[model samples]
Target chain A: MAETYPKETSNTVNRYKHQDPSIPVPVVLPMIGQIGHYPSDQQPHCYLHGYVSSRLMNLAASPPGIPLCVAATKLDGFVLTLTPNTHNYNYRSAILHGHGTVVDDESEKLWAMQLVTNSVVPARYEHTRVPPDNAEMASTRILKFRIESASGKVREGGPEDERKDRRREDVLAEVWTGVIPMYERLEEPVGGPYNRVGEVPGHVRRFVDGENARRWTYAVEAARKAAPIKRVKREDEG
Target chain B: MAETYPKETSNTVNRYKHQDPSIPVPVVLPMIGQIGHYPSDQQPHCYLHGYVSSRLMNLAASPPGIPLCVAATKLDGFVLTLTPNTHNYNYRSAILHGHGTVVDDESEKLWAMQLVTNSVVPARYEHTRVPPDNAEMASTRILKFRIESASGKVREGGPEDERKDRRREDVLAEVWTGVIPMYERLEEPVGGPYNRVGEVPGHVRRFVDGENARRWTYAVEAARKAAPIKRVKREDEG
Candidate 1:
């Protein structure tokens, strides 16, 4: 895990070392990432996956950052309505601003890209094709925004809910209110037909291994909760 | 739908009219999203997420006279390696650049946030509850990035394939190569558990009704193929 930018020079090695190494840094970091939504218009505001992880060049490559420090979510939902202005989507997002940096060089590039990949399947880099060449290596531009500060916001229910909200009468409205969750799951891997291999790698196994296997060490527990619920209760016939 | 920013005024309309409408606007955008890495670590890189988006925006999102654009992604994993550096993960992303506008008003704010939301979930905005109180709308920051150039990049397959790759290269390293394809699917809505009355709202239903059920949407299709095949009958089966 080599540090990419801002290398330590002979002159600056102990420039700040002698001083308080823990002086607060500025909120100079920039925000990046995507805002995802549900495929269905009805359940628009589903889940937003964004985060700001800790970035102290001194703490990278070894383990990288764990359990992302700051995260944000923007949920959205459509309001099929009688008017265009009335036609809207509900949403909420939590933006956690902080610090993080990009993996530097070819090796770290490979490591980080693989990290993102294995987030879906463990040991995935070990189970897949090696990056073709320097060109392949150069193709990916990974960046990290070290943590600084953060936040979260959301919207739920439906247009009727808001309209009833608008009325705000003593009577309770019949409009339904609830939240629809969105999830990203692993699909069964499709091994190439020509590849003459049967044994799945431990890394691949981490993602696709059959049930009753090792649990995902990373990823949010929401996914674990999303796993299949076998209702096959072995109940007493009595 | 309001079309007018809450602060829209006649003077502002005349000012905007002086500017060329098609000449492009300023917004966040990106060009080449290079994920740099360092293999053999002396020091480690942070894997910049925030500033990368910022820098990408630096390239895409405008500053003064430039147009708007964007290059956004969802960080899906952290590829773990056999040795520590070899780790990698599967991911999906889109890179775009062009005219953009930093959304700064109620109307654009409303739509921009919606656009970002629906970026992940199609038609979601129309299906959920939206805030009617103008006050809540006062603080939303939405940016409009009109894309001029764009492309897509994705990584799939497991480390097993790479292992086989290593064998062909006379590389004794039994590196695993396979996919841990990123997965995101809709979860059932936990409605009013009490179920006092009423059915699902029309807006939410649009989303749950399967905006992505067609199996041909960009978001879902990108993921579906990443899994291992179960059975191979005949190609003509389709």
Candidate 2:
């Protein structure tokens, strides 16, 4: 039989539409089995994961779950305006609300560990050793959060100066107003002291270079208010 | 007459001694006046500032003030172990607990704005227009938080695998274990469409390059267990 999962509510979709889908956004859901039925009579809860040492886990374990908020921001550019007050930044940021709790299931822990590891560098799981040893597994901990709500906010394009500033001849002539694109870049990998491999592994190199290029292009295009070009057009085509 | 401020306890100093001083770590302190003396009737609080529209501020302003935890992580390296379970990351992460509120004072708001701007890029405040106009000032908002507690955690150097894995003769010969240093790099600045300037200003250029270099050096040195060289040593003296 095919497996089934809960569908996303329109509320959730509208809320996170502005967020970069590549980044993981925690959500709350009911636990269900492969047969598409609820695993038990228990109510739905938030399932989130983080490192064993995460402070979020510690806070959650204490008495009632800790009311927590997580915010991540990606700076696209520095927006310069003719007037200092009108200066702004082109950015994309998300806020998540949740209550943290530790996960004790071994299998669930392993799965979450793999999920997070691969999230940092895709395909990283297959390249390394399989299932962790008893001690290794014991050392790792998982945090399950109860997510309540989340939202994403974004500001893009050039500066938005006041009408007076834009219309003033002196201000318009003397000041340059626009955006200076900014994005994170990953440098070429440097081999470790004990690395016997002569070349940086293909996966590592690809992740570093690919992520940098993707982010750079996104920031520049967003600042310019240009839609991302997915394919190169042929010169002969209209 | 001399003014005095509350001093950091020895316990706090010992706890944060290992943290990199360059990064801002949030702290909870009593509300104080221009002389740095705690106001007689006011209680202790968390003081933080971000761009006017920061979600952090909005969340903090709601009702009883959200029980907020702020976390920041600086990835030093990716630790590759012989086994997947043993693989880890060398990093420094800090968590702060606080309750947020808005600061309505115009002078205080401007000061915080300048402080945050300079923190992003040194000397940036002086390079930009001096005091903000009335409309500009009115648009900006500052958040003051009531901080409860904070702590930082750091992991550095190479990977640590299980004893059995390390002792296995075959595994020792076939597997590589070490740290691949990672850091955030700032790329060359892209000028705005309306920028008439022929070249990027010296301060902006210096900030992008200098910050990148500093972070790169710090991550690599931490992974290698080497003390950072503060300045170039004379060849003759060495």
Task: Give native contacts recovered, as a fraction, per prediction.
Answer: 0.22, 0.24
How much lDDT does each candidate structure score?
Answer: 0.35, 0.52
**Candidate 2 clashes between residue pairs 3 or more apart in a chain or in different chains:** A129-B84, B46-B145, B46-B146, B46-B147
Model 1: residues >4 Å from true position, as ranges? A1-174, A199-203, A209-238, B1-69, B74-92, B96-142, B146-151, B154-177, B192-197, B212-238
Which sections of candidate 2 miss by over 4 Å? A1-70, A98-101, A146-148, A172-176, A226-238, B1-47, B50-70, B97-101, B145-149, B173-176, B226-238
CA RMSD per model (angstroms)? 18.0, 15.2
Prediction 1 TM-score vs. true? 0.43
| Number of the top-ranking candidate, with lDDT as the measure | 2
- Model 1 residue A158 distance off true place after TM-score fit, in angstroms: 12
Model 2: lDDT of residue A64? 45
A51-113 in candidate 1: lDDT tens per residue? 223443344334433112233333233333321233323343343322234445566455555
Q: Interface Cα RMSD for candidate 1?
A: 16.4
Model 2 C-alpha lDDT per residue in residues B1-238, reported as the tens digit of each score: 0001111223322322343443212222111112111243155443444443343445446664534344455567777776766666677765434345677767667766666566556666666555777777776665565434444567776667666766676665555556667676655555554445556677777877888788888777766752221221111100
